[model samples]
Target chain A: MALDRKIAYINLSTGEIRKGDIPLEWRKKFIGGRGLDAYLLYTNNPPGIDAFDPENRVLISAGIVVGALASASARTHIMSKSPLTNFLGSANMGGWFAPEMRWAGFDHLVISGKAEKPVYLWIHNGEIEIRDAKNIWGENIYDTQTILRQELNDNEIQTLCIGPAGENLVRFANVMTGRKNAGGRTGMGAVLGSKNLKAVVCRGTMDIKIKYPEEALKYNEELINQIISSKVSQTMQRWGTMFIYGTTNSTGLVRTRNFQLNQLVGGSDIECENLDKVSIGLDGCFGCQVHCRHRYVIKDGPYAGTYAQGPEYTSQGAFGAEVGCNNMNTILVGNHLVNSYGLDTLETGSMMAWAMELYEKGILTDRDTDGLRLEWGDDEAVLELIKKIATREGIGDILADGPLRAAKKIGKGSETYLVHVKGMSNLHSDERPTPSLALGIATASRGSDHLRSRPAIDLYNLPVQVLEKVYRQPDGYDGPLTSGYTKYEGKPRIVLWQELCYMAVDCTGMCKYHTVFLSPNHPNFPEFAKMIYYNTGLEFTPKEIWDIANRCYTIERLFNIREGLTRKDDWLVDRYFDEPTKRGLPVAYNKKMDRKKFKAMIDEYYSLHKWDNDGVPTPELLKDLDIADLYPEESRQERKGK
Target chain B: MKIKKVMEGARDGEIRCLACFTRFRPKRGVDRAACPSCGVQWRISWPYPKTARLQGPVWETYPKPGEPIAKK
Candidate 1:
């Protein structure tokens, strides 16, 4: 079984649908899922198209091992040119939607052209239909899903939909499913909005015939057991990803009050243990064991009656700490509002916090915000802003364009207040003190993002032996690896290693929690190779997996390069370098990211990728990866009409 | 995610490192306990509000997973 899943090309303007089996060469080269998606997007999209242009294609794909008996193989990846960053717009989310899509006889979807009217795609056992979504237009995320379920009469179907934030074309708006699961960064939802497409409904009874069912079951059980055995998994199982706040906050490694502070002062209200007051237990996506998502109910407050699924550590950083709110209710309520409206919690919170800072500095006056005081921890103002941004009402309309665009419109040196990389907001976790994590976010293809390659375990100060073992992949780099979180020595190698490992993990559609994200002892290339081979009867060595990951990540880099990103764009903001951290552990306290060392680290990182100092992939490297023709001189000239 | 603070070390209770989650017995008047797993020295406030807070890591003593703990 070579996993020849079907990729569908749907044109909304002309009501035409095309389906075909993905070529085996592409499958072997790209490894399906996000890997395939990168290839599809890079090949299908011509450069210079506006993000909202009808030709800007949107792709949704599932990883190779998704339908197989695999560990946490329930992620779906979506990609298009970002309205916010205007570079490579890609987002991955954990949910059963991808698995349902696999069972519905497709692994990838290429949606092109805008519909004349609002509509949704309904895919059943081997059938695709374009259904009118006139009745559900402008519905919020929760309402849209509920309406689709009512119409389809299927409780088990999965729906990926957008809300008013997306329909209004909020630059950082996102797609949401299962209440909390969001393809949450880089404005994937706005792409759907531009197309007049509302939702993608999937339900099917098609069997996913495995090549070696018994061996796959045996190996998958072992893999699951190993995954559940990690201490990180134990903590995540109990407290969800909220547990990350424990060490990060105590160590003072978070972006507080819009990057004004290193740590949240008096922040126990948002600690992981405090979630117990609101949430009784956690939930999981399809076939996931770690269950790192919280479904909480607001116990008491104006928002007490509402319930929603997550306020992951991001929400805590977004609504709780970053906005200067020290109450759990504000975090829960804010989380609910963002999810309901299908907005990205990270970008939304970052925008709100940045605006609060601007208002505090007299940059945003009472006239701009309609006389509402943008005070810290003002629950009403915070909740009201979520509504405003989603509806594009008043000040929210300006903020909805995302920080970079909004900054371009407002010129009081306000752009300096933003804590973003490559025009996209970073996570709530401040990385000024952590060089590896800082480099990870600064160089992510989809702009400032953590999940793409954050070597989170680097903060754990694991032994250099462990670091050496982890960084020994993709290439046998016997360099000096350091476990110190603040050190720049060997950071380039670690970040590069994690990038490829993550690319492979994403290629397999496995959850990051199941891999060595938070835990150094979790699965890696060897385990992934075994998982794919045992499940699909596709023979692959760990080296092959690394090469495929390299190929995939390098192609992503190529995509961004073609979109006009240069070496200068592969760095963080001035605040990350200019302002020293005010609070944290002794090592991190009063520490600013050293520009010279970071520059050298970037140079070394480029060398590892065989990319030149300017961050261009060298011809030799491109030839080695067999992607030399991906962005040929002829294609570049053709685009320029030279 | 559990926080075990022996702040007022007034009555002896199980103390734990907020970083590595290692549970230990409160040492009499010992105001500090270094974690066996992550090796972060936590200040044990033996006051009205019992507290065991580990602020940073002692990297040299930090061990890899399943390795024997080096504790104080």
Candidate 2:
């Protein structure tokens, strides 16, 4: 079967739509979606281009595995030069959008140039149109989706749209699919808004073709069964990521009150039981049986009668623990507000926590808050401020730029309170003793995030005796009790390995949840490679997959470096280094990282990657990865020598 | 003189002398022989006591039906 390999490129200047077929060899080499998009971005690279420049292109691509016999949670990648990071930004999202795009007979959509007027792209099978969207241009995400559905007179169409936050060009604005699903990192929504594009409505009836249909069906069925029976899947199904709330809080790693404390006194109150009281049922994307998506109804509050699909683990932690507000109703309302208004929950929550701290310290007063008191537990005020942030009103106007930018604007000792690594707000997880996870966050391409590389299981499973034996420093000898959580020796190596593995998973359009289902202990790692091989007829071992992932990571790193990212950009907030948790017993407490030691570890990682000390790719490495022609020879040679 | 001879013979013979009612014939393929009058069974005189391996549930052991037997 000849699979549809067409990619649509829209030139905003002429409003000309060009449809081209991707070469068969390129498709085989790069796979599809993320890898292919990265290859395309590198080819279109222009020197000294700003992220918001008209020349900067945004490519939304669906994976080859999508819209076929793929498992649930197949993701779509939204790739562009990040307005926030000014580097190659690839944000992955899960919803019905990717499959819809595939069914429309297009592998990907490549958009460039700025539209002269407000417009939306209507993709109906092979026909494409740039329709006027002036009526819905400044609307919130919810209204835009509703209006677009009504305008098309087809409610079944999957829409990816932006809200006023994006229209106003909030640096952390997210591209929202439906009310609950968003491509929420790297400011891709801002890029869309800059193009004067309102939404992309995709609908089609084309069928996906698969190789070895019988074999693929059998493998998929077996894989689904394994996932449903896995321990982690059971926990996810039962609690929807809230199972970790109690564990994270107990372990003293749940970020609380702008990361000043690791453990919140009322953190345990946000567990599954509490959430279950308000939850209606479960929601999931197409083909997902393990519905980890939670649906909730707020019974009573200032923001009552509001229903939403989540306050997922991170969002719950962000709004509840981080702000010192343990009200489940408040978190639910916050979730609904952020989703409907189309804003990044982590960024909004982190900014609120920072503002609250500043207010308590008397650095920010009623004058700055526009008569609203910014208290630690002021749920009502926080919700209102979130609205403002979405609409860029009052204090929200200052905060819509994110904590890092907001801190720079409100300077006197406030920068210390802004917890971020890169311009992105840190996901609410303390990285005190789990230095490997912390290292992963610090070195993440997008920003301080947990999803980029999760090391929770690694930290949980490592024997305490093994850790104590590894890091035998006398000065930090707090006791055996601290061994489980402490950042001791051999952590950097673990972080580097996990990050590379996660990158591969991200590129493959596979759900990380399946990893737990298929094999808790290296669960079906080889089977996944086999599935890919059988489907694509491409011979790949597990080691080859790892190599491809490493190459992708290097390509992203090179992009960042060229965009002016340096070693200075790879460090966490000062509070994490300086402060000890006030509630915890003194066990490896007040631990600070030595810059020299961290640098040495980074150098070791670079050497392991066959890159230079400066974190650039060598010629030999790039050639091996099939990306040698992308970079100038002199730059590659310089990296090789280092 | 007869009683004294019987008693002396009973003590000497491995099977018993038939002169007294207490004396009995030795039973073949049986460990013990029964006395017809007293209803008591006694073993014939032997060099050592014959031992038999018991094949049933052990004392204080819980029994499960249909368990496989181990070959010794």
Query: lDDT of each model, Cα atoms only?
Result: 0.84, 0.69
Q: Give TM-score values for chain A, per-prediction.
A: 0.98, 0.92
Q: How well is candidate 2 docked (DockQ)?
A: 0.01
Error of 2 at A498 (Å): 2.8
Q: For each prediction, how big is the interface RMSD?
A: 13.9, 36.6
The residue pairs that clash in candidate 2, if any, are: A519-A523
Query: lDDT per residue, candidate 2, A1-642, as tens digits?
Result: 535658998888689999988777765566677777777776676745987888888888877667666567367788888877676676777778888877887878889998999899999888789999999998888889889889989998988888888888887788988778888887888899899988998898887666677777777776676666444464466557765664456445667888777766544456655777888888877666778888877888766676678767777776788899878777888888888777778878888898888998888899998998988777888788888888888888888877666887888888888888888778887776566667778877777777765555544444656444322221233333233435445555555555655665555566666653222333333555666655555566766666666667777777776676766677777776677654422332344455566666566656656776566667788888877777778765654465
What are the C-alpha RMSDs, in order, of all predicted structures?
A: 6.1, 20.5
Docking class of 1: incorrect
Interface RMSD, prediction 1: 13.9
TM-score of each: 0.91, 0.83
Q: Model 2 chain A: which ten-residue window has the lowest total lDDT?
A: A472-481
